[model samples]
Target: MADQRLERLIRQLQRHTVVGLDTAVFIYHFEAHPRYLPLTRVALSRIQQGHQQGVTSTITLMELTVRPCQLGRRAVAYHYEALLVNFPNLLLVEIDRSVARRGAQLRARFRVRPAEALQVAAALTHGASAFLTNDHGLARLNPIIDIIQLDD
Candidate 1:
């Protein structure tokens, strides 16, 4: 029964056509955060179950690349690339003029930091209905978009 209920909830979440991923999600995926693994499984399971629209901005990808460079983990870098390449359900959003303009506007109006604005702009640009993040600042932007914060 518990498994059934969980599956039902996962299906409901997946029914939303678009979902956005924040940088921390990528970090968590790489670093093996205890709580993150299960959620990652849920997300992957959702995607495998036919949830087709998952997205993350180039910024998050860039950020994820940094840790390996900082740690001199070239192998990890390759692993990261492989993960992104193989993940059919995840889409990578690039930084562009429209994204910058919208991000600037969000910064001005919401007083969001530039990084957060870019993140939100990418999500919005991708037509995401939910932005999945572990950042607290996203809660403040909840008025601007749907934010799902992962507190792990």
Candidate 2:
């Protein structure tokens, strides 16, 4: 069943040229979260192989590094930073004015948090046709960009 689900996810991802990734997806993948690892592994592999372009906001970088930094795991934090910076076909986007404006609009319209709104805004700004996330609440953004929830 897991394999079948992963296959379905791959198919869905293959249909898009670019996919937006949320921070939770990376955390699950890095930490090897049992339920989500398979989904994130396949999705990240596709992005790494350049089969799909991947995008995420700088907020993801900030979010990913905080726990490690707080725990005095600077090496681990550096590793993550390097991985994100050098990852192939993955663009770590900065929060620019346009993205901020769009994010504000999304936050107002969807009542999502600022960070969540910025993440979606970055993806949409960068032309991502699909956003891969573990947050089910983000499914509300399906009208603007296809939201692929890992749990689904």
Q: Which candidate should be chosen as best, given lDDT against the real structure?
A: 2
Rate residue 41 of model 2 by lDDT: 89
Q: What are the models' TM-scores?
A: 0.85, 0.97
lDDT of 2 by residue, 1-152 (tens): 89988988998998999999999989999999998898998999999999999999899999999999999999999999998999899999999999999999999998888999999999999999999988889888888899998886
The whole-model lDDT of each prediction reads 0.77, 0.93
lDDT of 1 at 98: 96
Which of the numbered candidates is closest to the native, going by highest TM-score? 2
lDDT tens digits, residues 47-126, model 1? 65667578888787678888798999988878887786677788888899999999998899888888889988988988
Candidate 1 Cα RMSD after full superposition onto the native fold (Å): 3.0
